[model samples]
Target chain A: MLNVEKIRADFDVLNPESPAKAPVYLDSACMSLKPRQVVEAMNDYYANYPACAGRSSHKLGDKVTKKVKKARELVTEFINAKSDDEIIFTRNTTEGINLLANSLGLQKGDIVLISDKEHNSNLVPWLRLRDKIGIVVRICPTNEDGTFNLDNFSQLVSGAKLVSVVHTSNLDGVTNPAKEIIKIAHQAGALVALDAAQSIPHKKVDVRDLDVDFLAFSGHKMLGPTGTGVFYGKLELLEKLSPFLVGGDTVESTSYDSYKMLPAPEKFEAGLQDYAGIIGLGEAVKYLSQFDFKYIAEHEFKLNAYITNELQKIPKIKIIGPEDPKLRSGIVNFYIDGTDMHKFAVMLDEMAGIEIRSGRHCVHSWFENKKIYNSARVSLYLYNMMEDAETFITNLKKILEIL
Target chain B: MPCIVALIVFGIMGIFSASHRALAEEAFGCVFKRITFRPCNTGFAEKIKGKILSKLLVRSAFLAKMVNRHYEILSWIFFILMVGSTIWVGRGVYNFYVYGSCNGLNESGFCAFDPSGENNKVTSVGDDSSCGITQQSEQNVTLENINLSGFPAINTGSKDTVVFVGCYACDYSRRAYPDIKKLVENKKSNYIFAHYPAKGDTMFLGEAGYCVQKEYPEKFWEFNDYLFTADKDYVLNKSNLDEILSKFGFDVKKISDCANSAETKTAVQDQTTELKKTNLYGTPTIFINGKAFVGPKPYRVYRSAINKFIFF
Candidate 1:
């Protein structure tokens, strides 16, 4: 029972004059459009109180520092972390994974376990580490529906130093059993990192409940600006890890001969940060907080279910991932028989003014596993309604008729 | 007394042995130098010193010249060789540390644009001027005219039926005098071309050749042919100009004499005034009976629009 029309109206981009004004925006999984509030918050920062955070002693600098600290606290609270000091702002989930892979001292004979359903960002770093540090990487098998197999994961995690897995699959919208995986890995005395890039926006993620050693998510996917993300780690473990990139802010004391590093979060952060994007992310989280997570989830589920049911009526259109509405979050990946996905997407835009994302969706390994070259994904958010879903299905049916 | 005498005798013998060894070392050095650098000896140096020096200097100079001539070339070759060796070492290091080079330099290199090669021809009609031509033929008559102004003019008989065709924004006028003369000479019966020099105006049409088929059902086809001829220059440069003109079977001379002709000056003045009045800024315009049409239209529309002013 989300007020989708009201929510849609709040975004300035949904206006008729906008080039990106799609009849139905079903690519929220790829990137969600920002609300006016989020944009305004960032604008306010730039217009009135623009300053570099934690650098100068002026009022503007203090103001920026205070706002940035509050943003960290907000993110920590949203993720249910024990302390705000554990949060480190990053460019995106990819940078977060890279930071961990490079910082952690993985030696020869050490093993890192991951799942096959991982995004390239998650998969490549581990592969790179295996090449650099002689660490072994074992990929846990996924089910046909792209869900994690707990038993298979357990077998893979044994004697491994790290078990990194995606909390939710971006390709299939199947939520992984990260909590159980974390529990088993902890029992086996292994560190766990969760790629929450797809999970953080759709549902409430309590890192404490999941008990993961590290969690990474991006701001753009959750209705904030690009080039902004958050990386969370347990404070104790964060203290032990070295910073991969060391620079001006990361050092506490320095000499020509040697340098002493700063503690934890500051040490991890090097160079200038995307302050505007971070401020926008903070505002995005606040804007999202207005809507109840349960209601938002239900709204998205209903729209996705409608699209799934309607798309199924057309012959030769096979939907990938979980068929059950309960298991699937908001994405519906499908392909029309004998129609090139890119061509189909283009025709839909030009002929019917409908927009969709058609590709491997960056989970190339999963698509390769399924032997699919590419797919068209219609991902719904809380602002989407049943009417939008109906229009999408109707247009899709028409497209099939012609193609 | 015996021990003291033995010590003194041993010390003297030791000193004598050391001195004798030193003298022997000096003698060996002197003998070695005498043997190696003796001026009288017919050894390698004494026998071929001049020849060797000449060859050595020549080789040294050649090597120095080679080094100077290809400093950057040698540096690049050395860098590439170094990189190759490092990669080989890296492969071995990878094998020893982290298994083999499964994904190491599998491909020859990264994709890059070839600077020496010509780029692919951009096919799409980019701007209004870029949609080079459209041809139209009508009722046993062909009207060939410049698609734009600033081109050579064509003389037309009053009774001739010339049908005008408009190109994309009057780009035809920008053609060189040779192209305009070719269009004029190729015309079978009357020439009708559009003139659009500014924005927000109708096209202007002119007449040339036998029967001026200005307004007719076949005007669109005739105009399209003329425009297509002009469009051939879109891709072809001067080297391929002969081939391009031969493709259309057009044999006309460059209009060098028209540079200071009264007709050319009058046409230019008329175009300038008309463009100023109508505010039509671009090319492929049409002027028939002092009326004009602007912008591009379908061949059928062109035929119907031209038919309003001329009869076949």
Candidate 2:
């Protein structure tokens, strides 16, 4: 089994001396706290070797350039990219999605299929493309328990120009069968882009094994620094795609009239990149790499199962999403009847120092479809233990009793 | 001889009589020359003399009135022209101060106050070749004729122009890039991304800078697509300091050499100090024509500022 206490100790933000007073931190789905190693890696970049990358022959610049390249390699290995050239660094998942929306050549009469459970980042761009290019965007509905309706998805993917699906729902933590989706989409002769923002951190993802055309994830959600993310595409596919940005480092040569661009990853990266954040992300991946995924998954599953069982005993509380532990990942989203989610979240924080996310969580369409205004979500990660879950359950019982 | 003397005497008497009657009419009824003059006391000869004298006096008075009226009209015209010219000059000065120079070359330019000197200088900070404003060392007194800090003034219906200047390597800039892209996509009246690399930030700054223009040509067009991108290092590092320019077509060598020269550096430093004195805080900071607004503000702030500028 993984050592929870050791992992918790690695994260300095969990200490009581921290200015924010060390929250219980059950909101890893939103953003994860940085480990000391990740923070130090970033600090070292600014403290000692800070320089512009890929420009100067100076020692500092060369060092930073190597660091950025190494970070790219790490990400390539992490995601099982065909080559390092297939990985492009971006600010976050939103940018990655926008990049695809701009470059993917969706024309009039083109059909783009998406799941109903997509985040706004995934939904809005396709919707915008639909408006711009007159493409048809078909939303595949999910089952009541938050699992993908494969039959409907299969029907929708046929004759579609593109199929974009969220690998895991951030709202409810139900994992979608992305492999099957990709297979069906390819059969239909459509390109596939996977929103792996939730999946990459919680579990192992091998893009080559999965054979998806494109995948996107953020650094912060996986214990990396903010303002860093990765976009992985198949090598051939990446080579086929045009870059969304163009500038100094991306081109091989240029004149007043025209210019020739570099291939793939370099072309996609157009400006001075965030070296420090990418370095921190490398450390974050390295730190996480030491953990046993099976143990991490099992530990979180046990605690989440315990929390779900206890929450069921409370009156007027209805859990949203799959009730089965096997169906859900580490998130538990629920609402108490007659209790405003915001008010409930505040009381939980004030009474117990338990941090949770409330409201639609940037997936307003899903909540709107369900006819629910908002819900409170308490997500768990590797740092959480059974004791923390017990403390939460006990506090929640008291809250329900008072209400 | 007796007749001639009598005639001259009669003429003087007639003139005096007319004058006296005119004064009496003004004093009583406010009408001149309407009161009846005493008929010539002599006969036909005395009547002709009185008529001739009366005609000459009336003609002279009418001429004097016309001259006075002519002078009044000329004075009114001159006053109107003076007021109009004053307003036109004031507006022209304000526009030059706020939006650089409107006139071609040397005749019109920014009116900047020299911080180091006692007197303000009307420096030609635009494309005035004859002004001897050639590129100089930073230590030189001549200033580069562009206001690098000002946002482009765009009037697109009700939208205000918000310019974001950043290098690709900056973490904050990366985070802000997508938002800037969205602003461009939304077609807000005035939104531009001005890509300026921080000193030594090289890598993606060039490539990403070009990609922004290549991928989103419409948005890039909106931004004028001119700034440092990843490939500018050659231009940035060139010894000649004039060869390396941005894909957006800004001469990087010229800008860099100018910026690094002692004079421009001093001016930049002084301008920074002045900005601090004015309490301007932080970048991603914005201005609606030099009126500062702190930023990373939401889309609403941009929209509101644009609305105010457009409507008012």
Candidate 3:
């Protein structure tokens, strides 16, 4: 097991003994706690080399260029991608998904399959493509219990050009069977893209292991700086996809009349990048790499189980996802009966210093279908401690009683 | 190579909402997808140079080459200037945002006497004595609660009401701050902080006291201690509120709402009403046993007044 106390020391906000009560930060599955190292990396970039990279020949520019190169390499290794060439930095997972939606040649008659539990990022891009180009978007069904239904996926994926699904959901924290889905999709002669925004932070997601052709995830969700994200595609597939954003760095050379486009990653990245965020992302990956996935996953499982068991003891509170804590990953969504969820959330933060998320969890489509408006979500991270879960459960009882 | 990577970093870092959106999402994600992806355009200089070189090349290729050769030097200067300007402008913008004016001087059309700023200071303006309209409203306040919530009276006392009507940021207020704080620390008298915000931001700063008291009812003094002792020109905003509230681990958004609430505004109005009752001449005005201290005075004098109120 990771020495969580030592790891917690790296995050100033999570230290329980600090003068200020460290908030029971259960919102990490949305955006993880950035280690001190990640922030310092970004601050160093701003303080030292606040210069334009790639375009400038100055010393600062060269330093920035080198930092960006190192970051790309780190990301390539982090995802275990084929090469750094296959890794493209994006604004966030949404952009990565959008890039694929616009670039991957899915014509009017072609089909794209997605899980019903897709966040708007994975869902909207395909829907837009379906409307803009003549393509059909098919939803693969999840069981009544919110687990993926493999039979329905096989039925809907016939003649589909691509199957893109969220690796893990922010809604209920159930990780979809991506490897199995990928294998099945590949058998159906379809490409696969995994929105790993929630999964990549918690577990080891090797592209080689899953045989995933495309993977999209955000840095902020993984203890990196915000606005930094990664889009990983197989080199050949990336080469085949046309450039979605065409300007600036996307080209090797250009004239008024003609232009020669650059390689896969370069062709996609058009605007000035967030080097600080990118470098910080590299630093963040290095920070998380200290603890193996096995340790991290186990820590989360224990905390989730503890919190879930405590919530089950409460009267009239319903856990939204799978009853099994392991299936819920680190996310536990529940709503107490006979209370306004929004007020419950406010009281939790104000009264108990327990910072949690209460809303539809951005899976409003699924919520709307069920007619459930809001739920209080306690999402954990690697830095979260057993004591934090105890505080959450204890505070929860106090809030419930007071409300 | 430069173009591809140039923007990669800048685009990610410069977009304000990148981290802001992340904060909102990590907090609970967004209510709506307001700004999903806004990439920072990093190669602006290159684009301008490209345009300039293209224009110059049409005229004379030799001159364009000559200019291109020295572009590295020009870029170095540009980079330095941009960084310096961002820092410079950032400070000015922050000060103006916090202090309600440039250079962080609170500007009330009526200038009360300030002992802190020298004549040369950019923040100082208007005669310090000019703001006073000779004491009006003769009905003296009893040794009890006023119309507004200042600091809740320490204890219901037969002791005289010491009404303090001043801006915490004003020159004389800075002088009186520590001494009054010393008295407040010693629990000298029943102090009523009747605020007359001579500067712009202090009104909201006063409102913050009442707002904060709503959440942590007992920490009004602790909050007041922070207000009186911090940097003379430090301003309050949402993020600054985040720092202060997080210290106590309170909900920043809730406190911020109360600070900006209509009820808080009513509390400030009551403060103004209380200020009117004090017959205020200038800031650092102390009303003890129906007598007044006009400007900053000795700690012993305040001690004597408290001594008189208790013993007389």
Over 4 Å off, model 2: A18-21, B1-312
Best by lDDT: 3
Q: Of the candidates numbered 2 and 3, which has the greater DockQ value?
A: 3
If you superpose only chain B onto the true chain B, what TM-score does each candidate give? Answer: 0.25, 0.29, 0.50
Could you tell me the lDDT of residue A217 within candidate 3? 96
Report lDDT per candidate. Answer: 0.64, 0.66, 0.74
Report the error of model 3 at residue B80, Å: 61
Model 3 per-residue lDDT at B205: 73
Candidate 1 residues lying further than 4 Å off, grouped into runs, are A17-23, B1-312
For candidate 1, give the DockQ: 0.01
Please list the residue runs of candidate 3 whose C-alpha ends up more than 4 Å from where it truly belongs after superposition.
A15-19, A337-339, B1-312
User: What's model 1's interface RMSD, roughly to a tenth of an angstrom?
Assistant: 37.3
lDDT of 1 by residue, B83-193 (tens): 686687665544222211112211111113212111111111213423333221111111233233433224545433333433322333333222333434543334544
